[model samples]
Target chain A: MAVYTQVSAEALAGLLSGYDLGDALSFKGIAEGVQNSNYLLETSRGRFILTLYEHLVDHAALPWFLALTTHFADAGLPVPRPVRDRQGEALQTLLGRPAAIIEFVSGVSVSTPTPAQAQAAGAALGRLHGSAPGFGKARENDLGQPHWPAMAARCLEGAAAIDPQLPALIEAGLRATRDWPAGLPTTEVHTDLFPDNVLMLGDTVTGLIDFYFAATDLVAYDYAVTHAAWCFSADGRDHDPALASALAAGHAGTRGLSADEIAALPQLGVGAALRFTLTRTHDWLNTPADALVTRKDPMAFARRLAWYLKATPNMVLGR
Target chain B: MAVYTQVSAEALAGLLSGYDLGDALSFKGIAEGVQNSNYLLETSRGRFILTLYEHLVDHAALPWFLALTTHFADAGLPVPRPVRDRQGEALQTLLGRPAAIIEFVSGVSVSTPTPAQAQAAGAALGRLHGSAPGFGKARENDLGQPHWPAMAARCLEGAAAIDPQLPALIEAGLRATRDWPAGLPTTEVHTDLFPDNVLMLGDTVTGLIDFYFAATDLVAYDYAVTHAAWCFSADGRDHDPALASALAAGHAGTRGLSADEIAALPQLGVGAALRFTLTRTHDWLNTPADALVTRKDPMAFARRLAWYLKATPNMVLGR
Candidate 1:
């Protein structure tokens, strides 16, 4: 979350005019993320999340968000469809920012999901990928930057700040991630589908949120991203491979993965982790005290890199 | 070099009572680094690097400095051994701090070396590992902490401050490295052997300096470290398989390598790179501008990681 400055209720209320409601009840600033300002909007009609673009959510892509949700809902993939104003505009000017009203998703976040959950995530991803091409025009996810080296740099920077032993680990990362051949598969990917992103009703996944970074990339890439997330704990490392097994199972449920995909999983997992690690780690050192954003340590994702090195078996690795 | 405070010549002379270089000789002050407080020292004795033991190097490990270098020198490898005073102490009390004087090794750092050079580093490492056990006593390189969770937490703390993309990465590293199965092959290893640490003269390998983080670990670990350094240029994402072949050849010339060693080289190369990248990257974010110690950019090592991933063959990356 990268909250900067403040949003007033009056500005928040002004953006609420388009939604179908009995009357405007109350509005409050809810979230200040890296890319957007979110408001918890209430009305006699229902509760909704009004988000103003702040970080990387493109207003140009605002139509994509509105249309994609409508498509997903039509496809029976339960998602909160964005609501347009009376003028049929999906976007509106709110406090000099583009804003949209999205149906509030329901479900508690699953922090420590079971193997079944991992598989579910994988299956959901497969389903999403399988269905995505039908929903929107081809586009790039544009993860913004290369994950590994940037991440490694962030970790090394953190190690220098306080942890001495960590510097060697960073050195180790630089050594291991150095030039070698690894190819990638591109498709539509939800690059950030960790446990926090997925909302669960008991053991089953009910909803997924935070689609600000969703775009076309590798299906294997999503597997790697989910694997890194589901397979690990609070730290960037893992003591269990069950999450991996579950993710594989889920992915397998959707479409049988090839040897190349299996082999590439770990590397992709590393890449995904590195992406988050670098960005979050950067925040840790630079975010202001008043900001709600939290900084992440680069070393956390770096530590898990070794896991990818050993997790995928040789037979499964593409020859 | 993490210099909290600079020590003056008078301050240092006050510490060395018997073997004084006089105030005119060793000019001491704060130097740049995230590791140790380096004071540039010169006298009739020749130019030397005076380092105050910072967070990374412990005062108790002083003997290892003298012992490891002498051991490497005895094994026909050029190592920077610390100079001892008449009191038979390599480290002396200087300004209420522990300090050591080492002969400044002069050589141009290798950016791109021949395949022979990479192999030499491997062979040299094997020889060094073989020689380390001969020391009278073993010293553990206490980087002080190895808790992956804590490391990840730090990343999380800084993530919101610097980059919002970090939380997932921080979590990934913590979870992955937490119970990784590929345990180390304990031997005396140079945990921090980078290109700058390994000096070269006219294509032939002359010396391996900086034993501050030597420990009993995998000999492959050192290969990973040096390979990452020798295999790639400052920035490139694709590693040539030829580099690995050269490394294997050079290493094979010294201590005989196992098939396992050869197979694991590529992955180890990645491991080494990732470790350093994270540490240096983190340091780059947090280190104060006023500090003399220059923070290293983990990005400097990113190209090699990309290269390693691309060029790494499935056979070499064994199950």
Candidate 2:
């Protein structure tokens, strides 16, 4: 439910003059992506999504994001293909903001995805990981372990204002995962694969969106993030073992995991939980009360971290 | 941009079970109407608008609004025909709010409508006025002249906080229109026909939407509202005489206005200005700072009223 910027019809007409997509028949701001203002645009050519990148996304990293999706789409992966203007550029400026028109993918994003949907999402993610390695660009994960200490410290500073127990809980979680195993396999990972980002038609995954968070990170950690996302209830405390097993199996079928990767799943899962917890805590504290975007509750991830603290590798691996 | 209630997938699926419109392929909340939650719903059937009525609309008035559109649509008027469910009811409950699935009308709404578009809108509005007399159900205009005094008082009470000159200006408007002309011809009127509500494909008017403000009022008053809307600049201060003349010509071409109606146009235009000014003033002052809906600038209508206070019938009618 976000449309931070309002685009006028006259401005849209001026922008469309550079594109070959014909005149816009209908243009509407849609509540889709959280990081950008998205509009469901219908032109004489077809239906397309016009996105104006918001402040949360760095302009320098946009080319990488566009290229990554273009790479996936060119490889016949289920992703939104960026539509280029007559000048052969996918990105342009509209209303003083970087904007792009991407092909509209038809599928409903499920909030409470079933086990079958979880499996399909896992398989799609594994395929993405395999395909993305061929792309030559490398982006260091900006929200990874190295940045966690600073984020955690910021969260601790505002902890007492948000909740009395937040600081101690975050400190304990940080201490537990400070010595995570190193030298794991690295690849391009969609650090955010929450159910909202994956589009599904019944049991099939039709599209994967919001690649703005894609970065070079541990492959198993991507699976860990997905597991944390899909295999938990809304409360974040209750884990669904069936969904987790199915997701893991789906990933194995596409891109099999190594024994070391399996062994490190629990620690990476804890790390994944902390990464989200810290970012969400920072957002929860920083976002203005009058902002259009609703901040996710950080406690949900904290609850997941609490569960991971007591769980063994067998719990996530279903050994 | 309003999607006050977030509809979950499970709830959407439940709602669709009662309709023949196959599973939802894509559902995106649209930033269109301010008073309701609108989603551009694409199902296996086709495109439709799924609207959940907000608290601002009275629940009892739902049927009258639906039936009125249904009547006009059946008569081949350019309106969004309501799609009835399996029970043959257009209005139903979804996400604990009065919801309806309306046929999606193609074409884009213009912010700054061209003179030709203004003419087309005038002609279409005339047709609607002619066709709506047989709608059987009659709803009194809730924001009519009788309600103006209380609204004026409310605005005056809060005027100093908004602006120093507001109270004096409003008091003058209230005193000037206190004894408005009586015995005007009344009929079903679309009171809120702003440029954004009328869809146009090139120069043709494709659809007129957001009939939630429709009621039985002076037929000339509806035209007055349209004149103020279509003839004003974005700043709501400057009036385009050519556009106003064209709009008047277009309306007269369809259903010629009576001599009395033409004579009352200026006073009605002033009333139209006051009606909107009061409502916008109320919303501007009352809407919470954290509310998702942006309060429109009341000063726009204030400026319009100031213009109307000085204009003669010859200026509006081009006699």
Candidate 3:
């Protein structure tokens, strides 16, 4: 949540010159998304989010991401579509960085979501999976299980320093998530459907956002990611069974889960936990001390991994 | 430039319950305003800025600041007024910090301001001085000339570390601004009227904001602060003669500076430069490395002080 690139008023005016968005009225940097520099840009026409892709984002894959979001938005899902210019370009360059103006989806992202909100968010994720059957593009899940060992290796030394037991926990996580359950239902999945990514009004989901980490993956695994994010407390030490049950039921109600998918919840949950734990560990070690970014604690997800290791399929499903 | 406090959605909802602003449609942490946590809050009624006072702010002086802004806003000068709750209390507490909702003024703060923009900004400052006559509340200029020695002492070692010449320059600055000009006009001044603090729409001043540093001080001193901020380059090395002349003329056109105030511009300019230099230096040395803040370069204002020490009234007033 930082504004890495500073866009000047003149530059913004120059950028908007290509489009029919009209003259700039108010522009303020938004501290929301982690990976990109976001600015809440308001013009004579309307309010929109102007995102400047930071160094971390792969420029080559940006078009695919935008297309996926467009697909979701076209399917009547609560997703922000990249606004195209008069030149029919959704992707443009600004301040020497790839930039795009996105539709401003109005809603609040709940930090501590209630059971009803969790259910709504879960339904939104299921709807996203159901909406993207016609999207022809496919991006590999680079952060999938096969990549765990390399991520673990890079994090081993730093993880050991944070806690002596952390290194062992990570190693066990890698071992526990080894066997892949073949022949599962696959779809265009929002690989990172955390609660924070869902925007809600009361008990209804208004916007499902931050689709940058999206790819064609197992629908059940996407459900597992959402489950891991919402059902547990911030520190990942406490579980809310009610929230978990609500979330699973909401997803199941929208898109019926197979018996195999339901039974595989515990294993998928382990994979999700380990995936986050590794990323957080890498970020904690590598992110500079002075960067205007918050480093999520690696231990939070590490604790979640531990919980998932001991959990049964019935326990994870809240049955 | 950072969100120090994270207000949960529930906490925000609870805070909004006391107001007639209706339900929060969107809330995002704004990456602006260094001293406080700012959020762009949009409700069913309208958009507003929710500010949470950080540790740096004096809680006691908050009401006075709010009153001062309300005073300016009431005069229809494009200043945002504090939106009071149903209890008629502007100052409320949320997440264990003093909080208030302010009207969202629509305009972009220019990074590289044009000469016309500088004049408009100056005219706005002059209007602020003209507008307030019966404002009973008074705030001492704690960051005035008297505070320079202590600020310099605290920054001595660090200043020397930044440059061997910095300490000497700071010492010389204190001596140059020693003899305060007497019998000058005093008014409630926006003591920190930097270019970033002034919002504009096509060279017309739309919002004169960030009045936390407002105090009863020499009107010329406030003019000097705005001059030092706008009429020079960001590094404070290259002075813009056209911009300086335009700014002085703009202020003079509105309020008509006395001969004494005009002559005192050079000295007041030096004082203004030093005040900012010392504060920036203190922040540079003291702010933690991990802070989600952009620490401004102290040398920028120090260069302005150096130029001001050598400048004449004619050069400053663009005669």
Candidate 4:
């Protein structure tokens, strides 16, 4: 939501000299991709997003992210394919930071998506999962169940300041995820497929963006993350049954879920909730008071975890 | 730059329904304006910038700003004209904020401007001053000479924290402007014409933007402000004689300065430097450490003021 780096016109021209994109016509710093500085770059050729990777991005995993998005694009997903320069390089250095240009995908990201949009987003995620087998890359889900205990401990140290109920809710969330299952299904999952990551046009998923959090993880866990993200109210206090049922049906229609995967939905949902809770709690506690970014409330996910602790598989998957 | 407000897709759609620009093909939060939320909005008609007025702006004076830009556009300057709705309204409320769409002007703002570009910028400023007499509107220059003493007093309180010498330098700058010349040429001037405000392609100036500070003021004061903005090194430690001479020659080439405006160059230059020094000092001492905006060094303009305090009219105006 902020441009951390200022790109000069001379530096931009130097960067564009390597590409076939004609003389730069217009360039603007865009407030997107929190971890990187993005510019809406328009050249004689076409519109593209010029991204300068910031410190938060893992430089070693840069190729993997590009390859994953390229794989998705090849499979006909509306992903922004990294544009290669004349020397066939997608990544290079500009202003002492790794930079790349990607095709600009046009679509609106709805904040409060309608049920039809939610179904379309689910279908898009299912397609993403369906296409993962063709790509020959895998990364561990660092935020998965095995890491939750330490994350919970770090958050618990200062969780009292954010909310007095946070420590107890986190402990309860940890207890609920004790039976975290494995081996049901595996795929490269977009672990952060909130509604904002999915672009929509009239209930159709036109683009699935922000693959920075993609990693090899449980299919049910990925589904659980999406369910938790989409089926809840903004405050995360209440669930929308209509949206949940439509989303589940949409995902199931694209790829059939086995009985084991379906049965594990409730526990995976709890784990998903706890994962976000711990991370948000940590962010809320650590983020500087004057940071331009608005810190998302950890209690939102804490409430989601509370709901998932008592929710049955039918309530989760809407079976 | 940062986006202070997030406009949802629904709200954007609702906004577009008022105009005939057709559905929004794409909308992105742009890091352009410091005082407002600007979005690069694309539709079937053309590209435009949708600006949502924020707290720093005076709501009552918005129509005046819009009308002034419209007046500039009408006078053939490369200013973005406000787009009107079916009912001929450019200013409206979106998400409880005043918002409007302006025509998108194309060109890049150079950080290290060439001497030729500096001359062109001066010519653009000259054209702006030349075009002003035709327009029938006047607003007090809120950031002009009259406002500096109070601004300097406020900045002096905490100037030591920034630099020990700043307070003395501010006092000296105040003394230099104590006999500030009056009864000079006056017009509607863009009081803040930094390099970023003037967009260019090669030596040709295509756009003169950011008129938030435009008000009726001495024509020489405006020139002095621009001269201070463009003819100095990034650190303000050194001046570019070629750039200074070219900028003055260019402006004079377009609109000849009187002997009084020419002789007042040194004093007005000192005043301009002091004005920016005070503002930047106030911002530096007051801006929260966690604020996303980088607080510009007030010392940069302090150094400029120091130079102007000793510089002769020939050194400043390149006689």
Candidate 5:
């Protein structure tokens, strides 16, 4: 979400007059994302997050975001609810940016979540997978958009400066899997269920944030992403095993990971890690500093690629 | 660079009133960049590119880009001279965007560069290294941004989804070189010298563009980036053995490649690839779609890592 250029609040409020969120008390962008503009807002009775749809988000598919969150909420999941306009529409135009408001959750993002916490997250993620099937949104996930491998190759070019072996590693990964997983359950998964996205109150997981990358993907893929997030250290190196059993237990409490999912966890985890690194590399290569967005280093994630492999061995060992 | 929600050309033109780049015949953004809003413009004088100063671009270092290009042109290098205004101001304000105009080189970036091409590019890059030391500017490169590693770790998390082993490999690389090679020549280098930034006519390299990331860095690091870019295949694996030599030839045509540089090439190449893949991954995790920017994959570059390690044993084998 490019923010180098500022977006005005008054202009956004004017366009949102068509919504059911009641008269806007105020709306101003809260700095957080690189793919979309997030606004903290106050309404007649509550505080909410107003988002300006950027590129990765499809305005036409917005009903899915609103509906999925609502569906999960109705299913007794702790998730935000989309505030609709008086006109009965959840999606609307604001400051010419595609807009929507969701109730905000206040809690610390579990940056260094405990193993049990990870297990719980894993469990919750499993539940999310279970609930996603019920979501009206049943679209295929855009794993690597427009051109995936080509973009990776491009990034490989940039990172090669740091490590001469980088290009071959990239190519090996590309050759390892050129096509998508043949068959898997597709559901609305919170694709980016990193520790930072999950809010925590002391030891209990509170709520999740940053669902801008959520989409219908393989449930195991979500698990893979979670595993990488939960198990890695700040330096992107492997740590003690994540709360895998607890996560599985929690997930089993709601749903269950099949034999296939267990087998595919390692590959999926690598895929998630690769995806984020490539994307970040893109930002590093292009984003203007004035964009007010911080560019993340792709190497941190690259280092974790080793962690994923180690986890895979552990995964099989546990099995 | 962030293209604002509302871009006003008139506002930009007002700032450039003092500078003359001929009448702005037309301005159409060429949406393929990481740091600036680049437009292909047609003026009475000829074709030119108008670039808005973007994120991380230190406007204070404009002298490097301007003076270097001017120096090269004066030294018989086919280079683009920045167009200055009546007041000899090369930069002007446009619609709140800081911009400059440069002569456009006529050529397309090569999709496939041969070993010979790689050598030429290498040599030119070496010459760039030679020239970097003499650039009268006194500025330091800001590659030590806090967000770089975080972004890389984020991508590694994603990479795990594709191949679990990847995380482990990356971790090893990071730990192995916590403290980079010492006693290396460091200077201002074209940090963003990706293939797209290099223009080639037939087999001859024409010019280099986009110097926003150009700053003081490890000399070997620059060569690593150049090799990673010039030596790989679409699959992200396989490089030419003679490639480094070709670059050496290009540089040696005027300057020369040191034995230290040649010995360090394989290792530096690996580093360069890692940097890009990780950054690309980070962007993938965060990129918004409206930017039409695509996320890159690190697996492709991950393969390059091992390849470089293997190539190292043989780098001096036949040579």
Candidate 6:
């Protein structure tokens, strides 16, 4: 939620000359994406979001992200379509960084979503998965199981400072997921569909954003991540079971979870909680003290991990 | 260029219900104003800027600021008009702070202005002064001459850390402005018409923003402030004399400067440089180490002061 890079007017004008977009009327650095500098660009053509990929984001993976979003938009999903320049390039270089002008998707991201909204979000996720099979280019989930132990170890190093009991709980979660259900419906999954990433217009899920984390992963695991994100309260200790049930019902209506997928939901839920807790913990500890972006509380996901430890598949299914 | 407050979707929806602006389609925190939290809000009606007044702003003085812009917009000036609610009140409370929905003005703010752009900006400033006589309300410039010495003293306390020569330079500037000319063509002045506050469409000045610093002061002083703002280069030492002359000519074309006002230009320019240097010095010294907004270099204005020290009124008038 900070614009790290400053784009000059002359530089922006030079970049826009290659495009059909009319002369730049207004350009403002906006507090939107965390890993990129976003400008709310208005031209004679229309309003668009000009994004400059920051160092934190892997430049090599940008084309894949852009392609996935283009595919989703082409499939009629409410995703931001990358605008191509006159030379027919959607992704190009600007200020020596990979940049793109994206059609601005309109909708407000709800911090606290209602059950109906959560269900709609789940249905949208199902639709997103349904549209992904034809996208041949694949990217590995960098923050997946292979990276979890290392993140957990890093968190454990400073766990006592955050919460004395956090390390033990994280260790237990790792032990529980050691032989987690293997090869259960691999598909393109939005691994970070937190409430902030899902845009809402009343009860309808109008848009899903931040596909930078999208990768080929277990279809059930994607639902599990959303469950943890939408169902849990701000503190993460409590969750609305009805919201979880609604989300499952919504996904089932579209994709219909298999028996193995259904059985693996609880384990996936625990893994999902662990994933976020470790990442948030790392971010909370490492974010520069003076950075304008606020570090999210890791304890919220810590409490979610605690709840998932006692949760069963039946509990998640609201049986 | 920072959003200090976060307004939730529910709170925003509740606020918009009081207005006729339909529903919010998109709302994003934009990096615009430094003193307030500004959001680029797109509603069913049109695009608007939502500003939440931070603690630094005096709430009592808000109506005056709103009315001044309203007056300017009413008189065909390119200023953002404060949108009134159903009850015809532009000033309202949102999220426990004084907030307003301002009509979004088009055009980009230029960091470096061309001579033509500077002239247009100066003409706009003159137009702003010309429209001010009937505005009944008057607010004193809080950062005016009376406060300069105190601010300079504060800056002097920590000046050595920034630059060893800064204290002597600031002290010299203070002594030079001690018996400065007073009571020369007083009117409502946009005390801080820095290049960033003036918006330009090509060579034409399309908008004037951030009127929070608007107050009753010497109209010549306003021009001096702008001269210092628009004429200086990035390093602040080198200035385009032709740009200064163009700005003076543009202002003279709108509301002719009096003989005494013309004579006092050099002194006012030095004072203007000192005023900004002191405040910016204070801000630079006190800004939190990890703050997202980068502090403006005070040395830039200090260099402006150095230039103003040797400047004569004729030098500013291009005679």
Listed in order, the DockQ scores are: 0.01, 0.77, 0.79, 0.72, 0.02, 0.76
Q: Which order, best to worst by TM-score?
A: 2, 6, 3, 4, 5, 1
lDDT of prediction 4: 0.89
Residue-by-residue lDDT tens digits, candidate 2, B25-76: 9888888788898999899899999999999887899999999999999989
Which is the winner by TM-score between candidate 1 and candidate 4?
4
Q: What is the TM-score of chain A alone in each candidate?
A: 0.82, 0.97, 0.98, 0.97, 0.86, 0.96
Among the numbered candidates, top lDDT falls to: 4
Please give the range of 10 consecutive residues that has the lowest summed lDDT in model 1 chain A.
A1-10
Query: How high is each candidate's TM-score?
Result: 0.45, 0.98, 0.97, 0.97, 0.47, 0.98
TM-score on B-chain, cand. 1: 0.77
Model 4 lDDT, residue B299, Cα: 92
Candidate 2: docking tier: medium
Root mean square deviation (Cα) for candidate 4? 1.7
How many pairs of residues collide in each model?
A: 137, 0, 0, 0, 144, 1
Runs with alpha carbons beyond 4 Å of true place in candidate 4: none
Proportion of the native interface contacts kept in model 4: 0.80
lDDT of 4 by residue, B1-319 (tens): 7887899899999999999999877889999877899999988899899999988888888888899999999999988899999999999999899999999988899999988999899888898899998787889888888888988888798998898999999999999998879889898999899999988877888888888888889999999999999999977899998999889888988885898998899999999999999999998988878766778999999999999999888888755
Estimate, for each residue in B20-44, the C-alpha lDDT of model 5 and write its tens digit: 5444443334434656666655455
Q: What DockQ would candidate 4 receive versus the native complex?
A: 0.72
Best-fitting candidate, scored by DockQ = 3
Query: For all candidates listed, what's the TM-score of chain B alone?
Result: 0.77, 0.97, 0.98, 0.98, 0.84, 0.97
lDDT of 4 at B241: 89
Where in model 6 is the C-alpha error above 4 Å? none
